[model samples]
Target: MTQWVFDLGNSRMKCAPLQEDGRLGDVRALGYGDDVAGALDGAIPAAVTGEAASAVLASVASPARTAAAVDWLTRRFGCISIVRTQPTLAGVRIAYADPARLGVDRFLALLAAHARGTRAWLVVGVGTAVTIDLLDAQGRHHGGRIAPSPRLMREALQQAAAQLPAHGGDYLEFAADTRDALASGCEGAALGLIERSLAQAEQRLGERPALLLHGGGAGELASHLDHAMLAPSLVLEGVALWARLGADG
Candidate 1:
């Protein structure tokens, strides 16, 4: 029996068939602005959904947007399950007293990290925003920090300062032009935050934790951090894990 998992983020919807063994097959990504109805069209094959045993989702999008996507899924798949941030799951305990306040994506990412190993981890998600969470070998969350992504930083600069441009730039050691400067400065800020977090994590954990990077914007910053391992489908992986565990039930 096949299962479907959808990871609905701020900018895109990443969907894939969750294999019986818990691996994803043939991932499909769709970008959406304000709504996801159109993007889901024909993305999943009808035959696949017809024979599917279950469907699940992990979303960090707005409530209205989530409702729309859930509505669509229900219409096509009969029933759909959703993953939510919990205070504790699969031996992992969240730092938040109010787990619901924590983003579902972050919580799922933590679950995915813990499931992969018992080692200490610094899970960094670079997307609409950059989020860094520390997970110890014992499945304890040491809290996390969130900051504007390089793209968001550039957009903010352009929006507030009339002359700065948000697009068309490349990272450089020493920027020779305004575009390069903006790119470097914004990207540099993200890198600086991660580096500082790494140092702090080491001090707190008594050893440097393995870094796991995910999200669309991760590629731009991952090159700067040699230790980061890119896990592009982390959230979906978490969604699949949660579905398989019957936690979404």
Candidate 2:
């Protein structure tokens, strides 16, 4: 039975404790904060039985943000945290330049999708930022692009301009009131950004890759996303895949 899984995401810090018989599990989201190592050092032990699997595979948006978390994991596990640098973990080989520069989360999602044996995919992670990564039918990660998250754009609009009042989401329709309107508009903006990116990807790839969306805000945008299949845990699945692969290697 797999033990524990941890993901220090772009926004919140989350961990899950798996059962002995492989019956799925419960995830705990430790609220976000400034100190990655300090926050994670404190949270990781209490969540996992300390003796649980020390191998933590993390995906970080910022290299610096990931470093501190890796440092903390090192102290506890005595095993260096394996920061995912592309070129595949399970079956997804990153074919982008400076392969290590790819986001660990995105690669892991691609890895997880590949393990499920999908021939191709447009792995989209929606959180503080929305990234659209592509993998060809041959299970190779082509590359990806990043854009301001719909929420961040909305917040930026509201914060920079007083009247907007900071709103964001996946609502496709216009709303009746001011706040709701801002929210809906934000969603519209996100939709447009993703739609165009997907369109371009489809054009280049010659088909609609299986669309997978993961991250904190994925729930809000998943339904409205033109994507037929969506799972918030793609990253976790990838993490799980990464762990299994590491064990095998």
Candidate 3:
């Protein structure tokens, strides 16, 4: 039977089939709008729901939205596994005193990063909010930092000041126009944080950790950083790994 992984975030839901080779197949995404069920029904292919498949989900959406998604998946798949943040799993250990307090999405991303190799890593997620996580060469998490993403910054500014827009503009060292200035300032803030985190991680680990960027807004920031690996399907990859490890255990 086929196994599927779903990553439900604050803004969107991403799903993909876990292939026979233990890799993820094509990923599909749907944004959450007024009608959650309708969006899912319209975006997911009929073939996926028609067959006998199992599903694993890691959701950071609201309770109401998560309940709706669980209800829908329950009707479509024979088995459903919802991912939760664990203190220790598959070698990677969580640094949070309360494991449940750490977001599952962040945990899953750490899993995917640590699975890559023993090299130290700085896993960054740029979605609704920016998350920066540090993983040592031994898969030990060293806590993380969260900040508003550039998009969220713009949106918040737009809300507070009607003159600014929530989108558009380009990142520049010194923007001449208000739109470009807004983009530059917000994106520059995120970049500065990531760079600072990288330096701090290097100091703590005594070696430069490899940078891994993931999430919807990652592309915007990838070009600014050197040797940054952009893995948009990272969370889903972690879900697949989580499922595989569970099945093995």
Candidate 4:
């Protein structure tokens, strides 16, 4: 059976099928276009499916849009998708007091970490916002925090002050000049927030979690994070892990 998993982010929906070796088959990014379902349309992308796999999983960045995307995939792919929830999949047990409040992206990132590494893992997703979630040594979900990202800071400055150039999340080098200052201002804000959050969390938790970074801006964050592994297909990774385990039951 073909194993397929999809991750729908704000700007694009990404899919990764399972190869014979069990790694992600091929990575396909479908940008949001006319049809909300267009996020899944492409050259069969992987082995085209008449029916979705025995199981399917999805991680939607925006909670409000999750239902529509979930329905769209189930209709198009002919599979019932497991939306990350309080209990989540049968694989990882979430101990977060308020599991519903957990971001599906962060939750999935934690699962991805569990699949590949030891416990006491930290998953960082860098996008419109930055999320840092901790999975204890026993794989229990310890919850995490979210803060403004570089783009968020830039947008705030653009709104509050005039004459500041609006820059989206771009990997660019700025010399120590006015342009750099603005860039620094935006990135600095995000940096400061993450640094303090990580430091404090480590102190309180008493064990530093392995840092796993993912998202559109994951590359940009690797250089800044002391210990980070760039996980481009994290959402997909989580989806794949859940679906595989679900099919067993």
Which digits, one per residue and each the tens of the lDDT, describe model 2 over residues 29-138? 76556687777766666444344345555757367877777666665653444645655455567877777777777777787777666667777788888888888777
Instruction: Please report the candidate that would top TM-score against the real structure.
Output: 3
lDDT of each: 0.89, 0.69, 0.91, 0.69
What TM-score number comes out for model 1? 0.96
Off by over 4 Å in 1: 51-53
Per-candidate TM vs. native? Answer: 0.96, 0.81, 0.96, 0.82
- Who is ahead in TM-score, 1 or 3? 3
Per-prediction RMSD in angstroms? Answer: 1.4, 3.3, 1.4, 3.4
1-249 per-residue lDDT for model 4 (tens digits): 676777777766777778765568788876764455555555344346657453365655555566666666566565666656545553466767777767677777778888886567777788778887777666777667788777677777888886776674343455456556766767766666667766766786796667788888777668876877788988788777666556442
Report clashes for each candidate as comma-separated counts: 0, 0, 0, 0
Quote the RMSD, in angstroms, for model 4.
3.4
When summed lDDT is taken over every stretch of 10 residues in candidate 2, the lowest stretch is 46-55
Top-scoring candidate (lDDT): 3
Q: In model 4, state the lDDT of residue 77.
A: 66
Candidate 1 has its poorest 10 consecutive residues by lDDT at 45-54
lDDT of 3 at 36: 66
